[model samples]
Target: MNMPDPVAVFRTEAAELFEQIESGLLDLTHRLNDKDQIDAVFRGLHTLKGSGAMFGFDALAAFTHHCETAFDRVRKGEKPATSELVAAVLAAQDHMRALVDRPTDDHGDIGEVLLARLRCAVEGDAQQPASVQPNPAVVVAEAPKSGSNTWRIRFSLPVNSMVNGTNPLGLLDELRDLGECKVLVNTSAVPSLDVLVPTDLHLSWDVTLTTDQPRSAIDDVFIFVLDDMQLDVETVTEVPVAEPVAAVSAPVPSTVAAPIPPVTMAVQAPVAAAATTERETAVSNADNRQAKAAENVRVPAERLDELMDRVGELVIAQSRLRQLASASMDIQLRSVSEEIERLSGELRDTMMVLRMVPVGSLFGRFRRLVHDLARETGKVIELVTEGETTEVDKTVIERLADPLVHLVRNSIDHGLETPEERRAAGKDEAGKVLLSARQAGGEVIITIKDDGRGINRDRVRAKAESSGLIQPGAVLSDQDLLQLIFAPGFSTAAQVTNLSGRGVGMDVVKKTVEALRGAIDVTSQTGEGSEVSLRIPLTLAIIDGLLVRVGTGRYVIPLSAVEECLELSLEEDLRSRGRSFISLRDSLVPFLRLRDLFRTGTKPDMHQKVVVISTGTERVGMVVDQIIGDHQTVIKSMSKLHHDVATFSGATILGDGSVALILDVAHLVAAGQQQEAQVRAAG
Candidate 1:
């Protein structure tokens, strides 16, 4: 029997709590006076601090305690929630993640630096706020045993309480801290090893306490875990002076340890009532809300990836079975193979859905970035997002994050102008950066558009010519001219800054998008703005592709890119051999002879076909010997030797136990366009 590590479970939960904290903090920056948001932020911090302390994350607890206090002031309306304060906490949350990820690593003075900044942000030219006083209502003091009242308390925690970092032992000890207490453990609920969940809590305790403290003090002992637990407290009777030991039916057994001296804190009167009342109300609602939330099972990300791999393999195996069945004369085998194919497809769909997460998660992280960037550049820039509900593969989202960050940073530091510049340009005081996503066919188009100072075409041309990248007087279209920004080490900025400059970002964005077998497009106008769109496939693992036989080898064209297929007449093929252009719907579309392109040296079949494929606006015809029907292509990575093969994006295993290369539609389209440009230039 393998038991899950308690510490690992706590860390998983801590990560979620941290995300909630960050989200609330980010939301608070927009509505500084929203009390609900402030309370939400405070609750997240308070929970994180308590959970950290419970799990022995002392540094995390200590660092988070200060943040919690900072928010507590805002919650109590002492100091306001300034953008400075929110930014400080946002930066601190990143460090908290590091601490959660690497608890053993020494964080050094990073926490202290953040704390100092937090203090400054909170103070902000005003006198420092008074320190919060501890609650006096929770004070524990011992009076004479004769004057003490005995109470019988019985409690049982939820089975998952221990797994959630709640320790029953700690609760029992706190109860013991109150005067003379005898605890009786009831283990009847615990089962044998075969049926028991090791991490679950099963034992309940019946504690009899004789203390002079008020009822509120007893309530404070179970303050944190009052939710998700069944607790019953009743005063049996006031004990007389003659029979203190006989207050309860059971004597103080040998298991009862000597009570330690109690520690008392002095809390001011004004703080006690509100704090006590708030705790009670919070406890009342916690059980219902948190119990509902606890239903979700948190699975590790690697496990999902592993599951997806298995599903992909199953899909491939099913394809092989279908091929074998198609060749056989037995009807029953074919029928069974068809059913397996359908089931396998459904399973694959389910796996894909599991991997598809909303783009909102990707979009959410940018709020903090925009906030910090606005402050860093001393610009009033607003971030607007749309189509956040669109979903994409998780792997794509993760890989796209860094490139998107680079693009947004470039937009803020270079594309968007300073406040003074905007005023001079007769534009609104605040510039707008729009981040939007939408699904087109099988791809998701994520665009970063900014309404600020547009690209300086002359500066770009000058930079390219000065760097010897292009001809001095080359004529280029608007789109082509804008694309020069993605050339290696290309930049039009006059000087370097901490955020950008010295020529970076855009070229890397181009490379990253292409590495994912995706295409990027740039559109810009003087004084209006610019939009850089990244069109990436929804999933990189598997796709429905049109398998075509070119020469003696077979290749796949993404079904999403294939429009239609037409037979190439022998006469037309021979007459237009040098031209390599075919008439389609009264338009001349460029065609590529895969036989010549691959240099296979094999004769074309008698009935050759031209498959019309496209990437965005460009269309190209791929000549193949025969067209194989749609195939479920489980994409396999190209070998290191073939990594530089621009024509083939990846390889897939055919149903006939043979391998087929996946054609790179974007690259093929580019090649066709380049050929057309050359042909036109010669003509």
Candidate 2:
């Protein structure tokens, strides 16, 4: 097994820390008096600085320290939290991220500019009137006493803390910075060499400090690691102090066995009483933390992809085994095959669940984007999100990010009205953009809706004609007219802007969504809003499909889309031959004869089956010769040469080593709907 690089781990953790800090700062915009958010932002910056220094990111540490100090002022009531301060820090946070990503690159000029802005914000906040300032008495940290007192502070960090980018020496140096201090190393917990892990720390520390600083100052030293470490701080007073111990540069192995010097009864009495109760509580808390940590293990994403590929291969191999067993007369071979088949299916299901992640993470990233865009465009845009907890395949979410960005930018730039324009239009000054996700069968529908000026059908048609994308005054449905916006080099905007109107993004959005085996649906109502929805499969690796033979060619119909199957006798098939419509119970559903559609050039069997499939509310039936049992399908993408073949989405290998195409349900349903419309027009 290969261990992960410590630097890589630090980078991942630093990314998360950046998110936490950015989120807190953005939330602070809504409530500048939120003390909890201030503290949270301060802690994130403090940890990022310490961890950056630990991982040799000196530039990041140096830059972040200034932001930390600025927040510290707000935290201590020296300067109130203001919008200017939050915006300045948010800008500085971006610089800090650059430092982390490229520590050796020259960022001196940028750093200086950001620091000046931060200083200006802080100085400006300090000039606020007393009536608007925070309550100094209630919010301030306790001031240090005039007289000095000795403190006995002992602490032991979690064994894996050092492995997690924590520097023990940094903590010790901070303690020394407080005042005169003598540290004693405790290594009695070290195990023998044969059984020891090199990365684990087994030592603790005991320190005696003489300082006038309040206890809060001491607590600040361990604030980042306090949740997982054991710390005991108590005052020892009125006793004659021991001889001033010389500062030691390093610890020797001999010190491992050396015992701590005994203290007098005067100091020991109070320490004994406090140690009993506090130690018990610390132990219980530590145990709980350890248990919670053990519950979840963070594995790199590439590893999960690798595991999924292996599972896919296992599924293919099991399919081959099942075919072999079916033909064999040996009872034992068939029994073994059946058992392995069941276990492989169970493993596949579990692997799929592991790859599923909530859409909330993807949605959370848009908050900062919306904030920045609002500031840029001078638009009062309120972004509302729903169904963030809906789960989708990680691959789907990753690929959907860019397409969603394009849709949202277009909505804000073109669809939404400016604040003043909204007011003039008898609408609220703040325009609304809503993003929502929900699961429908095996697909997750993601919708981006904006309340503003809807898509102008006349403008879209005029643009289409002017761009030569359509003939003059061509007849088209409302949906077809709206979809023309996705044509190459199509733009209805009169002028170009930074966010959109370059005629680049919407077409790319269409192509990318289609590449993911997804479909896009657009709807607009004049003067109300426009909604664009993307329906994407829950997973791409494997699927349960109903296999059937159209003449001699076999195809896989996604089982999730199969509503029901009906048998068609020769007489019924002959009667519906011209119309291709099936009356089931009362309503008529359009049916397509696959043998004719594919032009297989093979005669159909006497007993045919109509496999009913649907995409949303529209249903279509495909007539086939035989209905094979359900198969576990591992989808393989079509080659570029055949990618434009709209009838088939992809291909999969069968049990007998032959290839079968996976039907594109959305395309066929649309085709069926068009057929139904044409027949009605003819009538």
Candidate 3:
């Protein structure tokens, strides 16, 4: 097996770390004093900086340090987390991502500009003035006589600690900061040169100090290493004047017999007890990390895709075996076919679950998008998200990102009103935008809603009429009219701006969503807000379909969308032939005769079935000659030559090896609506 390139691994992990940092910063903007968010952001930045440097991404590491430093200041409470600082860090994160992605590319002076802005934000927050002073420096002008005392601390760090960036000398230096101090090195544990590990630490320390500070101050000296290192801390009192010479031997240790100190030199007893308590906690944390590392392995996404392809081929082969088994009378062959079919299905389902990832991964990046858009438009926009736990295929998530970006930008730039406008409308000064996702059977619905002035129907109508998209007074339903916004080159704005009014985004959003075999729905109530929903399939690889035949031609209807199938009586069908509807449950449902749609040029069977399918709450029925039962449909893309065929989403192979087209529910529904509109118009 080939090992993955370490650099590539770092970049992938770096992306995730950047997302965490950006998300933490954005969350901090809403609650500036959230200590948890502050610390989380700091850790993310710190980890990213360290990992980048380890992977030889020097520029990325260098750029990320400024951000880490800024968050550190906030984490330490040296500077309050301010909106300006959060925004500045958010911007810097973008630059860091660029550096991580294209490390060798000349970044020019972008880093300096972002760093300068960060510095300004930090300094600006610093200028607010302090209310109270903190602890003074470690070395003070000769300790005050009233509270002067000494502390005796003996500690030994883990042997491998020094190589992992812990400096024993640095810890000792901190101890000296308390007051006048003397440190004795204990090196008895050192092995002979022949048996020694040169990189390991084989020594410990004993420190005697005098200071006016409290006992807690002594603990502060070893704050970073206290949990893992062996440290014993206790206050040492003054020597008796009467028996000053006796103090030297009062508590002398058997291991260290030579000691001539002004104060008493005691054996390490009480200090050892304090260290024992922390040892268990340290050991437990180490064990947990080790277990976690053993349990998980990081594999590249391409490998998973390759595995899925192999599974798909296995499924196709199983279908062939089933067909052969049914024709032959060999009991053994039939039994083997059934076994393979069962195993292949189990494998396919497992592969699908592996491909399914939570939509939260996609929703996270939008927070940053909303943050930047609010700044650019100078609007007070608050983003609210829901249904984040909904999951979709990884491939679908990747493809939907750009289209979702366009939709969100359009909402912020076009649908939302400014603060003044919102105020005039008696709404809150700040506008709100909601992004949500949820699963309905096999489809995942992603919606973007904004509490701004809704679609201007009159303006849309005018633009559509002028652009020849519709007649001047076309009698379109509210849903139909809202959709006109997606027409190419359709814009109702009086003037063009950088953000919108250029007649661009909405149409491209439609195209992209449709390419993914998804549908777009727009609904708006004037002055209330507007909602745009993209309903997409959970996966494009394979699906459970209801295979049916109209005349001699066959098609697959996604099983997730099928609600029920009922026999259509010839009298009932003929009674509603022109209207193309069936009265079921006392409500009229529009029906399409597949025979007519496909132009099969064959007569319909006496017993026809109406398969009721839905996209959201809207249902349409398909009139078919036969219900051919369920199939494990492996979705194959339409060739570019037939890519524009709207009636079919994709084609698949049947067990008999015949080609069958998968119906595009969303498109067919839209076509049914359009067909209904045309019939009414003629009437």
Assess each prediction's global lDDT (C-alpha) against the native.
0.82, 0.84, 0.81
- The candidate, 1 or 2, that scores higher on TM-score is 2
Model 2 alpha-carbon drift over 4 Å, by segment:
125-165, 172-214, 226-289
Order of the predicted models by TM-score, top scorer first = 2, 1, 3
Flag the better candidate by TM-score, 2 or 3.
2
Q: What is the overall TM-score of model 1 with all chains considered together?
A: 0.82
Q: What tens-digit string does per-residue lDDT give for candidate 2 at 489-600? A: 8898888888977898999999988888888899999989899999899998899999999888899999989999999988998998768899878999999999899998
Best by lDDT: 2
Structural similarity to truth (TM-score) of each candidate? 0.82, 0.84, 0.80
Q: Compare the candidates by TM-score and give the number of the best one.
A: 2
lDDT of 1: 0.82
| Residue 374's lDDT in candidate 1 | 86
Backbone clash count, each prediction separately: 0, 0, 1
lDDT of candidate 1 over 25-85, digit per residue (tens):
8788778998998978877887777677788887887788678767766775668899888
* Clash list (residue pairs), candidate 2: none
